[model samples]
Target: MADIRRRKFVAVLGGMTVAWPLVTRAQQPVKKIGFLSVSSPGAHAPFVAAFNEGLKEVGFLEGQNLAVEYAWAEGNFDRLATLAAGLIHNRVDVIAAMSGDVSIRAAIKASSTIPVVFISGSDPVQTGLVASLARPAMSPASA
Candidate 1:
């Protein structure tokens, strides 16, 4: 009887685990957001927290109402290119960049189609990351 009970419990657990993916897939949202920051974790802590909190306030929570992919360059300007390429490969709906002009430029170079939201100290237009902020369209070569 003990063996039989254990077998049934195991069977049920297996079934539930198998079904979980289908159930989750059925409810998953289509939109995905990728956030890239050039600053290190130590530098962007408050900004990251505030960004998450803002989303939470707007009825969106990380991994719940929406999906987010975060990449931090950690103040290394060179990593921005690699990070931007990674985000592009992930095919995120949009990218939010928190670095300086370098990151913004990288994001623009990574993909022209993927919309990028940049919070940078430098001028995005002058850097050619965007044709204009009002109509922010990125081209391939913006260096």
Candidate 2:
């Protein structure tokens, strides 16, 4: 059974690999990713580098296919809302809330259509950002 499951998984993965480019080609080119941070740019540079490295591992390169727009609050929580709004105005395809719950909340309140991906220290499900870890709630774009 385990071998059969593995074969099925490999088959699905191979199919997805062949279909991935076609799916992406049907969508908008130059995908935009919004980055929201509570720290200053200087302080978050290493984090940004790590993020870029991760993206590179997935075959994505900045300025070529993926475009990243950064918004830093510089320890000022109040600025996060405005930054989120600016990213929404720019129509970013997805928002990466790099800070804590504050940045995540700001991004959630900013727009419903754009999908928000957050890395938080707190429990996202308990905080009501998601229904569960296994299956996230759909954004307005998906709806």
Candidate 3:
């Protein structure tokens, strides 16, 4: 869980940095980030809180500089694809997929343009999510 939390923190920070320049240039509305998880919101509150705190530390406040759209599967792996589709339909700038490989793969399938940061217990490279742990593939959907 700690590893998951740390990955979430780093992913959000990277996403925000990538979006910052474009956001300032366009002067658009609050940037939107999509959070896709396999667990219920109630059960995943601590993980979400930790991620939010990390964002705050880097000067990005939710509802101020950014807005997050959360989708939970309630432990149902089948629902991940649907939830990921919804985030893509909403046109979120980035997606943080946490929980496991199922959620991550669902997000990967959902959008190629949106950046996806995934957390998984299994080996992502072996699963073909990336080329390797050290040098990941540069896909449009990959963060």
Taken over the whole model, the C-alpha lDDT of each candidate is 0.81, 0.85, 0.84
Among all windows of 10 consecutive residues in model 2, the one with the lowest summed lDDT is 134-143
| TM-score of every candidate relative to the true structure | 0.71, 0.73, 0.73
Candidate 3 wrongly placed segments (more than 4 Å): 1-29, 138-143
Query: lDDT of candidate 2?
Result: 0.85
lDDT of 1 by residue, 1-143 (tens): 99999999999999999999999976878577888888877888898899889888987777776788888987778889899899999989998877677777777778778888877576767766667878767743473
lDDT of 2 by residue, 61-131 (tens): 88777999999999999998999999999989999998687788788888867888877677777777777
- Report the candidate with higher TM-score, 1 versus 2: 2
Off by over 4 Å in 1: 1-30, 139-143
Steric overlap count per candidate: 0, 0, 0
| Candidate 1 collision pairs | none
Question: Residue 60 in candidate 1 has what lDDT?
Answer: 77
